[model samples]
Target chain A: MLGKIKKETAERWGYMGFKSLFSSGIYFNVFAFLGLVTIAGLAVGLHGTYTGYHNVYGVTRQIPWGVLISGYIFCVVTSTGLCLVSSIGHVFGYEPYMPIAKRAVFLSIAFMLGGFIIIFFDIENPHRMAIYNLLSPNFTSNMWWMGTLYGLYLLALIVEYFFLLDQNHSMSRLAGLFGVLFGVAAHSNLGAVFGMLHGREFWYGPYMPIYFIVSAMMSGGAAIIFFSCLAWKIDRTVLTRRMERAIMAVCQLTILLIAIILFFTFWKIISGIVSPEKYIAIQAFLTGPYAPNFWIAELGFGLVIPFILLIRSKGINTNLMFIATGFMLVGIFFMRYDLVLAGQIVPVFHALHVEEYSSLLLYTPSLHEISVVTAGILIAIVLYLGGEKVLNAHKFQKHAIVPPGAFICQGCGGIHYMKEGESQDDALKRHHRMRKVDREDEHA
Target chain B: MKLTNIDLEKLIPENLISVTKMERRAFLKIGLVITGVFAGGRILSVTSNVSEAFASGKDFVDQYPYKPHYSMVIRQGLCIDCERCLKACKETNSVPDYGYRTRILTKIVTDAVGRKREFIPILCNHCNDAPCTRACPTRATYKNKENGIVMMESKKCIGCKMCILACPYEARYFNAERHAIDKCNFCWDTRLSKGEKLTACSYVCPTGARIFGDMSDPDNVAYKMVHQVEKQVWVLRPESGTKPNVFYMKATRSSPWDLRKQDGAR
Candidate 1:
């Protein structure tokens, strides 16, 4: 049954077999190194799980979350952002955005799976979570909502990708719509998991959910540009005028998002300084231990420098976009790390004047924790590389002849009947033009 | 004598009725009232007061959600850093040396008039609106409906440690042996379920610093103390709005030594 499904899928989607994975020496070498790193990371994670997370991880009773949690957040935030950005094209019928739809969808799924793998190691009883998360669901819990919604989002994304590969645009669009909804809901709830905790002065606010969604869009935009540029490097054939335009559009969106994030950060710092509870945590970012992370990585690499680079590139230079996005990805990773650590460092009892908790608590990720986080990144890279090879770099035909009978349009999902010997591209254009005329007539 | 070994004889109970009046007035302005004082005027004594201590908007002393709302009242001033409670709790609960189910926090006031140091004993607040319970993706840590003690199902715990971060009191720790987040459950499985009225910490408290009882029973000392409206009482980190079941208040040295014996005799 598995062989039959694989054979049928290969025939339908034109999947390249296992031998094709090792065709290019550079690709093979990169994959081999990443695969080894991923395996080592997974081994370390399993060892930690078997021994005890407490013994292996840097987390303590004071700071229960560490770099691994940040890593997981980074993955999911990027995944949700990708889903949202990609949905704007394929699901919402945006012409300029269509070319990126397939690659973004594939990466979103890969990143989400990577996130799950990281969180699985972070959780002590991950198996129990799978069981009780369904059996004894806690509706009020933000964590529960986040887990459930993300799970649904992943499922929707998988279905959407499947239909996209099968060339069933209507089905893919339906699944993509659900994927977008679930992704947004899941991502916001992930933010609420931190935000709703009134005890955590640093994280407790309405800002977290809103910021997470906005930052997700920024991260998503950067990821697509970086990966597309990388894909172009790997296979020059993938870069058509349509693909170039899509990347340019995404670059512009990324620039806008970076500016918005900077504005959010500025306000976050300004507001946090005045609030007595949040002052110490905010100060840590401004001039204390976390100053470098905030100033150099989060602001410089994640926002300011990328903003400048993208503007200089004029959203046209793929090489500059690549360099800018590379810095952005690194900066975004540190942004998540700082967010998680800052909230926890200000010991819960800091306000109570207890000698033990008078100063900020410290946490440095253990080797095992670092390995697990590395594995998550490697998993995403490996999956993306594998998808590129197997799915012919997620290429879609720009022009084709229309078949007989009514077919669902990729853009509008509207059924259009084609005349004999008519081209698919012309039919779509004609349908769009007629719809524009109808819309104009309605306005009149 | 060293400060650790406090001399009970040298301690004088300063008449703070004026100060107490001011505190009561301050509390009253915020719609709260003091309840009961214990240990007959000791410099360090246990008191309990309640007026909507739970986050559910229900009158904690009046409505009493649980049939027996198990609660702990820490006499903040009475804790002498003896640490007998810690030892007893560790032994009873099999708590590892690296982790604790209960702890004493030392706050030294360099400019205080009489006492320069204060020991604040802390444990699970067992909040009626438990953030840990809410934060747990799985129903691993949940507040008991019957008695209101926050109970843990270790098997169900996915050890996300969300509960640890959610706890305002810093009462939880990752128990490597259990492979789950461990916390003070008022000795429910070890003592309370085994027909003991007090937790190991409360029973072994030589200074009667930790008082454990069912606040839902009006006849019970915990309930009577919380309902009387006499002495000033407070809970730690009230701004978190966890609505903790644990109460804290000052005690006098008038009869500090007799508290344990008196409660034991009851």
Candidate 2:
């Protein structure tokens, strides 16, 4: 089995860098170049963060956790989302979600790697966090639990992905369960990382941990819709009825979670208004500098627009689902950003009515900080395309309709098997709801 | 030296403040009382158990949590905003130019007489119920068992800055040189541990504005200063329930300068 995967993977990559570069077409080349440029930007960002982050990053003693931390949160949130979303079908044996398992697992791994890469630059001495984290464990810290659990979470995901690729069902199922446990634990603790803080009144409460998990589900559903739609467009493969249904189910979930989050955000604001201690921090997002991000990105684009779009689509319009997912992904990015930044911008001494801390603190991410975040995102995209180009075919082949011997049967739910017609993808499209794409794209 | 309840109108001189206690009702001087509001460039005592349930030393702690029961008392009225303690702390601890170990806060409260700026010096209160230590994951910033000083073990810090967010006073800062969170440790590394009787800030406070002592000892000057009923003394953000060791009191000696009642629910 190992040798079979090795052989297939080697052939898919063209067995040579120059040959693969020359052969994959202009669009592939453009994507690869974009990925490389992002890496270069990452290099420059690393240099800045390393040489003197104080001089380079827009962070100050007042606002230490800046955009880089926000970016890290974004990636990890996506990773947790993908893992939980994928596990519904793959682990719990849900039929509609089964075909989504492989791509979701692969993307989840990619997203997590992106998260780790961004956060590595946030710490002053990343080396020390490694040593002291294990040598002197502090079970009390939310960050400690978050870091350790995510480590375990990553390992479980990789194992789950590997088993899913090999079609070792038992092993993959076990690994998927572990991944769910670790992912959920890590993501909630990430919430507590903000929730547990005392002076930062906006985030200092029980709501954060619960909100993180629910939002992770919302994110996972959106990620699947976004990536899967892009996959159908690129692979040009007429999505099997099962695949479409799976996406619709995910869309329904995406909308539900968005509604839940919208509810959560509403209460958060109301609660803030009622509490004087929370006045400055809450005021920042409500009518202060961060108002634009909260209004446009977080509320409008993130929840309301996509929610209306998805509802109107009736969960069947693939185009509408794709568009809504796009808005959600953008909104999710700001959601994490606003969460991290809004909590920190209120200077700790603001309540004391000191001249030094009278106003809310300001932190606009520097070019280096922005680049590091952009690079992390670019890295995720690159890994996604790379995973698609090399691995999706063999994994998806069995699920695609090969039109066995011209007998179009609606007896099965997906791909009515060309019932009594000529052997062509065009012939298959005649009965299929989606248009003709490619076997090379789907089963290359 | 507990002063029994009295008609504060008779106690304080008429020019500064006039408080009249009628049977059960205490009438104020007809000053505008702003409840939970920030406006007109004035900040009232807002952290008044704002949202959280009130926490106190007796209710929050079962017994003395620390060995020394270290504490501080600031004579708020006497503080002329000299900032000598601030300078002394910076010099002793090598606090960076941008950061401070201690600071003085001035509130220009206006009444019928005129504007009177009251100085309230602030620092790491080193609360027995320190939120920073509780929030720290690695115990990097923990309460020192022997002295009750909240200290930082720089090496153990992950630079996550959870402690910074947890501190109500915003006492901690990320020191690039140390690559860790730094804060006031009551001059533990500089003076107190070095056989000095007082912290640098207390030692250099020429007017007895900042007093540091062992609260466990009743004879300690700091204990007497806070416990006395003749003067109104209070700690900042008592609602925080950090049960901070530091106490704030006004100078007993009268000055010609215009003032208000310093004893408000002390």
Candidate 3:
């Protein structure tokens, strides 16, 4: 299996000549430029942090968390979503999800790393955290579980990707199983980090953890459509009939997920308004400081506009799919941002009527904070482009992705393997024709 | 009025004896009527300082979470915003200029006669159910099980600041030098651990406004002051459920509010 992959890799690399690399398009060049700029920006952010976060970050004592935390959650939620959506084909053996497996697995790893980068700069004494998070393991802490599980999830995914590359079917599936288990645990635990904070009236509840998983699937579905479109554009490959069908299926699934999220969001707002304890926060997000974030990004772009476009296209238009998914991806980012920031904006002592806390605590992410997040995104782009070049992720054999026992092949008497240099249907046809020739030879 | 629980045998700190003998006798009657003073949630509704003293001193002596439930009582009527306690705390703890371990809050209420001002000193609650301790991911901020003081383990802190948000008192702040969150630990490190009987703020209060003592010890002045059932006792933001160790009352004697304590503490 691995030998077959090596031969395929060589064939793909033969086409990737020095001239082809240098003659990359304007889009590729922009990503390269972005990568360099963001790297420089990340260095500046780190330097500012080293001097003093108080001076560099816009976060005050009243609001310690800022856009950095929001961006971290955005990246991670997308990563978890990709893993779950991709596993539909790789682990569960759904043919429609098969075309996206390789790209999905690749992007999942890339996005998780991006998340780690954003958070690494935001946390003070990150070096100490690395040492103590292990030594002084707080078993009850949701943050501890989140960090540890994501670490394990990353390792499992890397192994799964390696196994997939080797075409080690059983081992890859086993690794994928581990990846899914830990990914779900880590993602929901990330939700628990905020959900468990009873002191935070806006965030406290069971909804966050459940919403995280559901939204993860939605984010995953949208990401696959968006990136798959980009991959086709980058690799200059036309989407085959099968690949287009796969994307359409995912598009429909994304539409449904968005509806679920809309329902959840609607009820969340309603309940928050009904509960007087959380009324001030509801006001803060809906019609107050975060109104634009809630109405424009989360509602309009994230859910409403994208939902209408996908429905109008009837899940059939490729360009419409791309545009909708792109909007969803961008809009979902603000969803995470709005949630994280809104939770902390209402000062804990707001009810006390103190002069110090007479108004809502103000916070705006400084330029340094924004730079670090931009760098994290740039890193994801670089990692993704690197994966595409090195792994030939776009060239995954769609036929081979079918999970065992999911379908009984009508061709070749229900058998499901191909001979050397033969596609699944061609191998079955050749074998059937040979049997008929053998029978005629016996009659003669 | 013979108050059954007002035991006179207790050893009192000199600073704790702010009220005169006549005021102490009147405290029992004052305590009986002040239970409803906090109902309207206005400082002006409290009327006389004697009534506030009556309301603040109720239900103290019976309940104690630890052997020496380290506690504090503030006589709000006597506070003149001298900021002596704040200055003393800064000196003792090396608190930076931008940060403080303790601060004062002011409220002005207008009556038919004129506008009256009240100052409330705020500090860490050292709560029995401390939200900060539970919220700290690294157990960096923890409650001292022995003293019930919420203390910071600076080295363990990653400066997550979750504890700051969790603290209903808004008492915690980021200490850049320590690379951790800083808060009032009831002078636990600066004075209490060094065998000092009083917190810096309580010791320096010139009008004898701040009372620091062990609520669990029957002989402590704080225990005596808060034990009367007739007087209503309340903590700030009781709805928060922190069960703060700090208590508040009004001065029994009608002394004018002034910055006279500034020279005494510095």
* Top candidate by TM-score: 1
User: Can you give the DockQ of every candidate in the order shown?
Assistant: 0.59, 0.44, 0.32
Question: Which of 2 and 3 is the better model by lDDT?
Answer: 3
Label model 3 with its docking quality class. acceptable
Ranking of predictions according to TM-score: 1, 2, 3
RMSD of each: 10.5, 9.2, 11.6
Runs of candidate 3 with Cα error greater than 4 angstroms are A1-28, A398-444, B1-63, B110-113, B249-266
* Model 3 lDDT, residue B21, Cα: 81
Please list the residue runs of candidate 1 whose C-alpha ends up more than 4 Å from where it truly belongs after superposition.
A1-12, A398-444, B1-49, B52-63, B227-230, B254-266
Cα error, candidate 1, residue A236 (Å):
1.5
User: Which tens-of-lDDT digit does each residue in B1-266 have in candidate 1?
Assistant: 36878877677766565468878777755542212223222211222224534435445444357878888877788899999999999999999999998889899888754457899998999887888998888888999889988988988887788888888989899887887889999999999899998999999998888878887777887766555445566778877877788888767654645666656766
- Model 1, residue A155: distance off in Å is 0.7
lDDT of 1 by residue, A1-444 (tens): 323457766766757776678899889889989999999999998998788777888988888899999999999999999999988888887756777888999999999989999999888878888899998887888888988999899999999998888877889989999998999899998899899988999999989999999999999999999999999999998887778878888999999999999999999989899999999999988998889999999999999999999999998898999999999999999999999998999987786687988888888899999999999988999999988887789887431212346555767544478767777778889889998999999999
Model 3: how far residue A296 lies from native, Å? 1.2
**Cα RMSD, model 2:** 9.2
Q: What is the TM-score of each candidate against the true structure?
A: 0.85, 0.83, 0.82
Clashes of each: 13, 3, 3
Judged by DockQ relative to the true structure, which candidate is superior, 2 or 3? 2
Scanning candidate 1 chain B in windows of ten residues, the lowest lDDT window is B39-48
